[model samples]
Target chain A: MNHLDEKDIRKLTEETVKQLGSSATPELVENVVKEAIDRIQYKAGSHVIDTSPLKKAALQQSGNRIIVTAFGKNRVGILAGLTGILARHKCNILDLTQKLLQEFFTIMILVDINESPVDFDTIKTDVTRVGEELDLKVVIQHEEIFNAMHRV
Target chain B: MPIAIEEILETIRMTEVEHFDIRTVTMGISLKDCCSDDLNKLKKNIYEKIMRVAAEHVMVAKKIESDYGISIANKRIAVTPISLIADAYHKEDFIEIAQTLDKAAHELGIDFLGGFSALVQKGATPGEQNMMHAVPDALASTQHICSSVNVATTKAGINMDAVKLMGEVIKQTAQLTGDKDAIGCAKLVVFANVPEDNPFIAGAFHGVSEPDVVINVGISGPGVILRTIREIPDTLDISTLSDHIRRMAFKITRAGEYLGKKVAEMQNVQFGIVDISLAPTPVPGDSVADILKAIGLEDVGAAGTTAALALLNDSVKRGGMMASSYVGGMSGAFIPVSEDEGMIRAAERGNISIEKLEAMTSVCSVGLDMIAIPGKTSAEIISGIIADECAIGISNNKTTAVRIIPVPGKDVGESVNYGGLLGMAPIMGCSQLSNNIFINRGGRFPAPVKGINN
Candidate 1:
């Protein structure tokens, strides 16, 4: 893969402006050049040779799910304890992400709660209690990721 | 590029250069639990509850205003109708409750306290009857207390008995406070199809469905609309002017919605409805009648003014409804005679007659608002006005009310200045033709044709 440097990008913008003449406003030219650079960088930065295998795995996990957004300090075994309680309640973890803001970390978890007969309130209480034990703040909100992405 | 950022900032600054912000931010508190047989405890409970609920309103409102650069015109409180709160009490308890509310409002630094009211649309409850009996003395004794009575609704019909009683009460309230320039009756309103969530004073009351605490914002921008209209060229057609007005209303409502949501969020309370009514002030250029006159009318009651007002009201609602999801209360232009300098001028010149104002109410918002009639007008004639306004509301399925004060020693073409935001108004005369037989029938006017379903 090849990437366009700043000089090349500038040249492309000038040429596009010349072809479009005075019809192209400055804001329009800026938007076009920025979009082109983003596309080139995304293609150059990709390391995966195949994306289909990842898509197949994502499709197989389609079920009732909930997303929990927690904000607090990071700690050891925080994910394990959170997932451990969900596992005890027969809940499945679908996806998770943790980002650090200074010394504090915020975690967002996507979990499947379809296999258990327990309602949302029960799962929320269990996860909240686990968060309290781990000294983290947690909120569990319902989300149907599969339906949201596919139906809409 | 586009319009210079400096020009946009200048336009924004121009909006504030002479802008007198809304005069008040009134909270409608419900006093349902203050009823007691012991008048002293009832007064204590009423005072404590109002003080507790409104203790931080002025502080929070001031902080929010300073932080956000938006001015809050007034900080006041309205409670559930005092009659409802005094259900188990006597007439003396009503006066005690009113005095307590007035004292609490004064202590809390509020300009006016509302909900000294009675709802007697179907019939006067025992407590409502007692409150009615005490209204003359209660209103005369209190300085900052406001009162209202709802004697009609679309579903329940009008109670002629209640209407007749309110007429006498209005006369008495006026005569007792006549020395105060008729200020007592000025703070009273007689309404039909009244809303529960209205944030304006003299009529605001905490509705049943409201949260324990909430902040309702009434957005007023008659000045902005008037400025926009003044800039339009006379060559343009009426539709073009309507379009311009609608677009301006949309922008104003958008600003209001943004500010309302932010205020509710800061107050940690539910976001109540945005009263998009263009409430005017006594300021020179901020009158609704001025907006009407700006659209080429010499005065509010001039020919073609009603048609112009109908367009303005319709376009305003259409624009405001699109701007906000929860648009409620009196969401149209308010033409309060004593509250608008232009209206006062028109009435003084004999340009806007009482009948023309009534006709204007058919198309504009609120009916016969803040009108001062002559003291000699009979109670039967007042009932006739109530019947006419309530009939408009019942037939059209909208809110309509009358807050007419029978100014003593003032007749047609004579003006009295109540000063400040209450403004000044010329006395409009009513028909001397007797309606006593009709008013004394004392039976309910059946719900309008539209209110019935076979």
Candidate 2:
């Protein structure tokens, strides 16, 4: 009962087709079917689903997520220096983006540190030291603040 | 990215360059249960209660500040007004309790501990009167303790007797701390319709109805708003500019609410409201006056200053209401002459006067805040000023207060530098015009018609 079988997938697909009607396409059908199955599994396991975006963001809070931003005068070794520290600390870089504005280089990384052996303060100190060596402005803040300010 | 690059950069800029930070994370601990008939026992109960409950407040606030990479400027504590719990004691006993509170605050590593206060909007009991009388010594002898007396409210009108007493109290406090240019007066506030959960000092106190312990936060970011207004085109209309301010206020309020709740959770206390006051520091670009100037004023006391401040205050409240479920306290722009560099400059340049500041106060969060007058400005005139401010508060149905300092032996040209967050101000003069006869007729100023809306 915890998992969906073949008949359940067939039934969910039929319901998705009915809901879409004239707007249905192969891509839409496939996406809707996948979403339906995921929802069923999620509800079966968790017993509750968050509908409000603000509450969803709050409920997603944990020790795993953080945001790291670094910006300075464009330099060659900035990325390698930062990434090297993260790799050593076992900090998983979930998403990264870098851009250049005139003479400055701006980089932002979303990191997961739940698997790391070091605590938050130690990681922050290491990152700050590397930033000082490279002469860049770096800050690491918990992800909750960002979600609270911008998501809603 | 889960959070957009523009959003991330905006938050960083607000914190790093724009001077955005949490002004205070004040823990309001109820001490109603600490009351006793014996003065010694009462003092012990009050001291023990504060020390035990707020032991982790500073540590937790520091942790949260680091967690978010945003600075929390002051960690503070407020308690149930001492008069309510220790009314059985004498003025000297209250003074001793103030010392005890000061000691606990020092040990807890907090900047200021508030609630050596009394609420006498209509009248005062013997205990409340004693607490009021102890104001001078309590403030003069203690560094970390703050006190406030509410002499007026919308529904009950102004307590002229209490108002007159506070005038004398302010003078005595000034004289006692005269060596530091009347620094003691800076820690005392006279209020009308004071809020129960105000997280700002020197007016914060836990109200009787509040829970055992709760956390309230006041957010500070006048520089961010000023920069946002500067980026806007000068040709834009006032309404459009107001929308921009409202949006910015929403974001800041959300951040404050989140931080306050987390701090409360860490201490296992109930979360209180977010006070969306744009409190300013002496930093060059972080003045509320600069925001007013960015709104097209020639200077702070220019012709349309009042109108501009009204728009700024109203838009901030509107945006804050939409962002948080619980929004209270004085949620508007604070225009303290000593604390804001632009306001201090305007006073030094003689572009702003006390009368103009009073007019501006009718539309802002606080009234006549941190204004320093000359030494010999008579107590009757101070009473008169307090009465006029209370009248504005009563008729307008809003919170208003006076934190005036009559700096001893100082004239208009000299400025007293208290340094740090207290800032500095040129001694502003008040009219010596005699209101002696009117103030001498000391009685309750009747409630205004606006107070009878219900």
Candidate 3:
């Protein structure tokens, strides 16, 4: 995972402190910094994967965005394994949030594949495969469906 | 975070758990241009035209399903009413045309093709009469062909002669397909004030004024609304509960319109309308009757059922109208007894009777849908039943229809099971009272007063 630089963390903490007023504490600042880092992961992989047959076909991209959600038992290296496949395909992480409740883990990932050469179906199949390998249930859908239902 | 987490989860849960889906993406193709004096030429023209226009329909619906993660339940086709084009042909020619339509639908992998129909609200032309005569044979001989006849309308009143003919036609259809529990009657609808752009069958048809080629979508979500009502606290007033129903309807209709427009764009056709009908299936959770029960009725036949249904039907339209620019078709809550598990249970327990269903139809969408009666019922009684339903529709100026099947050799204690979406129907007893004197004295019931006739 790519971490937020100190400059970005400092800016986030300043805003958090202003919103928190006198309630702001060192521990709250630390938690805010961690959340900011978990919310975005960018510019991680420079190398691209070799071209496969799946790369030649393009998914009928809907606004070039996709939502990936996963739920399962919490374990180490789950995020690393999931993000590694996205990185290899040159997909950008627009926003991400992951949480561990008791022994279960849940994640919601917003990814933009405008920069990736792989088709939508290929990337989705790859991500679902990686999810299986990590012992998690996963679903990927176009972002427009969410927009149509939730927004005007 | 562009969409709130709760909204996203709600959408997912609706699709995955509540059975929210686009009920159908129906392609309405006009066959008026296919009319010909030469019978063979007419048949060939119809088959080719439907095949050409709907070749990509199923393919496009499947693509949108996977891309958006919303499942579409059915892909169907509707054509212009055959009577207009079959005026130059006879009953045999109409039967052949029906067969041709069945073949084309089968080739294109469509489940149902509607519009083997004749509109004789006032009176039937010679050709229209021939086509109506062909209905029993057309429906029995073909697999996927559905037929409907408009025998009454608000402006034209009730054509009792046409109604009498339809009564005979339905009995013949039932006898012809009696091996399959009189399944032929399941595909035939007799209507008063039927909407032309209705995407639901066996009533869907490309209207005379519609574009040459259009796509209409039917959206279904009784399960979603049932869950929404269940989540609301009973302490809240009815008005507040209606607001919640409206909001959920808004979301469901928006999703339907999006998918419909996207499919039309991909197919390079005009998008017609989104029919926001709360159509239920045989599945337990996806039931309009359950929604009525959830609205505080002990059962679907309880005293307050019609009021509860009226509230649900109106709120759905209120929310759906705001969500889409074009809203047409019969956008009411369907209470088909066989298709809805809750309704089936209600009927089985003797909780809902045919008379109560008729009264409920005054407020709900379609009338007397998927009801099975004893084989011993007379055609004059069937006509009486139909005339009564038509009277309600013409008086209220809303669409009403009857898809009642009189199962051959079956009685009130017996049930007919056709399986699949045409769920099992318990034979409900109809009034044995005779209206033969009135039916035999038929010409026209005459149009009702338009206003100030309470």
What is model 3's interface RMSD?
7.0
Each model's lDDT: 0.76, 0.91, 0.89
* Poorly placed runs, candidate 3 (over 4 Å): A1-62, B451-454
DockQ of 1: 0.02
| Chain B superposition TM-score per model | 0.95, 0.99, 0.99
Give the C-alpha interface root-mean-square deviation per candidate: 17.0, 3.8, 7.0
Residue-level lDDT of model 2, residues B1-454, one tens digit each, is: 6688999999999999999999999999999999888878887898899999999999999999999988999999999999998888899999999999999999999889999999999999999999999999999999999999999999999999998999999999999999999999999999999999999999999988999999999999999899989999999999999999999999999999999999999999999999999999999998999999999998998999999999999988888899999998888899999999999999999999999999988999989999999999988899999999999999899989999999999989998999999999899988999998898898889999888887
lDDT of 3: 0.89
The 10-residue segment of model 1 chain A with minimum total lDDT is A143-152
What are the per-residue Cα lDDT tens digits for candidate 3 across A1-152? 33343345557778888988898898996676555444454234414321221111122223488888887999998899889999999998766777788999988888888889999889989999999999998878888888788877
- Report the poorest 10 consecutive residues by lDDT, candidate 2 chain B: B35-44
Q: Candidate 3 at residue B108, lDDT?
A: 97
DockQ winner between candidates 2 and 3: 2
lDDT of 3 by residue, B194-250 (tens): 999999989998888889999999999999999999998878889998999999999
- TM-score for candidate 1, residues paired by index: 0.74
Per model, kept true contacts as a fraction are: 0.00, 0.61, 0.50
Q: B162 in model 1: Cα distance from truth in Å?
A: 0.7
Each model's chain A TM-score: 0.56, 0.61, 0.60
Instruction: Give one digit per residue, the lDDT tens place, for model 1 in B1-454.
Output: 0122232332233246435244445566667677677788888988998899778888877754543334667776768888876787778878877888889989998888888888888898787899988888888998888888898988888888988888888888889998976788788888888888888877777776666666666777788788878999878898899888887677666555655565666666677777778888888788889989988888888999788788889878887887778887678888899999899888878888889988888887688888889888877888888888888887887788888898877787776788887888788877778889889999788887787866
RMSD after CA superposition, every candidate: 15.0, 5.8, 7.4
lDDT of 2 at B278: 93
